[model samples]
Target: MSRTVSFTQMKDGTREEYELLRDLEKPFLRLTADRVLEELRRQEHVTLEGYKVTRLEHGLQSATRAERDGADIDWVVAALLHDIGDGLAPQNHDRMSAEVIRPFVRWDVAWVVEHHGIFQMLYYAHHYGWDRNARDRFRDHPCFDSCAAFCERWDQASFDPDYDSLPLSHFEPMVREVFGRPAYAPEVIREGHVSPLGA
Candidate 1:
């Protein structure tokens, strides 16, 4: 049988109850990669900008490009997940996707996911009368160029219908491996760390 906490409210819980909850967390953490992959798979039903590919395919293409370019596992995974939020939070998908991966990948990878929307604006924002140069506001930020390059090279250009993208199964192991790392390693949190592609 499973253990249960007797308290109905957090404030009423005893330390023993809290410890039980903590113990449960370990198994839940191990399932994070599976949940994330399922969420990405759900993007197959979502389409954007009249693109010829589903959002899932777009994600696969982005990851495939990064992998072929010899990016590390972190970069490849980040690329794979960068658009996972389009179905739930289109208006602020970047922030949502970034938060989802923040705990698993390097800080710069999270930053790129967080800010790719803004950097991507440099492409079509002008058509909507928004400032195409809006991303310039962060010109001096350390990760600005990296974020811009991500949008320019991968995120912005991944809408093709003909690009041969890898199967999601090919990336399942990589996802599990990246998410299996410690959420906040001290070395990765330091300043000036770049992704494998140096972008």
Candidate 2:
């Protein structure tokens, strides 16, 4: 068995107890990649809105397209996970998925994931009485074109059941590698000219 802190309240925790808790966090933190992959697998069974493919298939298709288009690992992983939250938070899945990958990916990749939902509206929002051009609100934002390109090139077109999508297993290694990097690494922040947390 492992050691554990006994403090009932955070304010009452001693330095030794806090140290032990911090040590205990290491293994759990290391498992973050595994947990994320498991969640993606869980999405394999999630179907929505009469789409021709399951959420997992759609994610794989998107990632496949990104990889084939020569997108970097971060962008490919972002494509793979851009809709991971759909099964749990359909109303705001984009935000939820964005938050999951935000800490580990580049600023532009996270920005695309965060706004892809609105960009996707360019396809069919008008069919539901919503403005299909709702994405226009962000037209002046620096990442706007990138997000639009993501939706147009990979996301919206991923629903094809016959598309030759790569298997989830094919992306597992990339997912692990991407997640293994330090969250908000100095290089990513400096290259993107963004804050540590990409805020």
- Where does model 1 exceed 4 Å of error? 196-199
Candidate maximizing TM-score: 1
* Local distance difference test scores for all models: 0.86, 0.85
Model 1: per-residue lDDT, tens digit, 1-199? 2499888888998888888898989999988898999988888777766779999999999998888878888789989999888888999999999998888778888998999998998899989999999899889988888898788777887998899999999999999988887777766554457655533
Tell me the deviation in Å of residue 97 in model 2.
Answer: 0.4
**Number of colliding residue pairs in each model:** 0, 0
Which runs of model 2 end up more than 4 angstroms from their true locations? 190-199
User: Candidate 1 versus the native: TM-score?
Assistant: 0.92
User: What TM-score fits each model?
Assistant: 0.92, 0.91
Estimate, for each residue in 16-102, the C-alpha lDDT of model 2 and write its tens digit.
Answer: 888888888988988889999999889888775688998899999999998898887888899999998887898999999999988
Model 2 residue 21 CA deviation (Å) reads 1.3
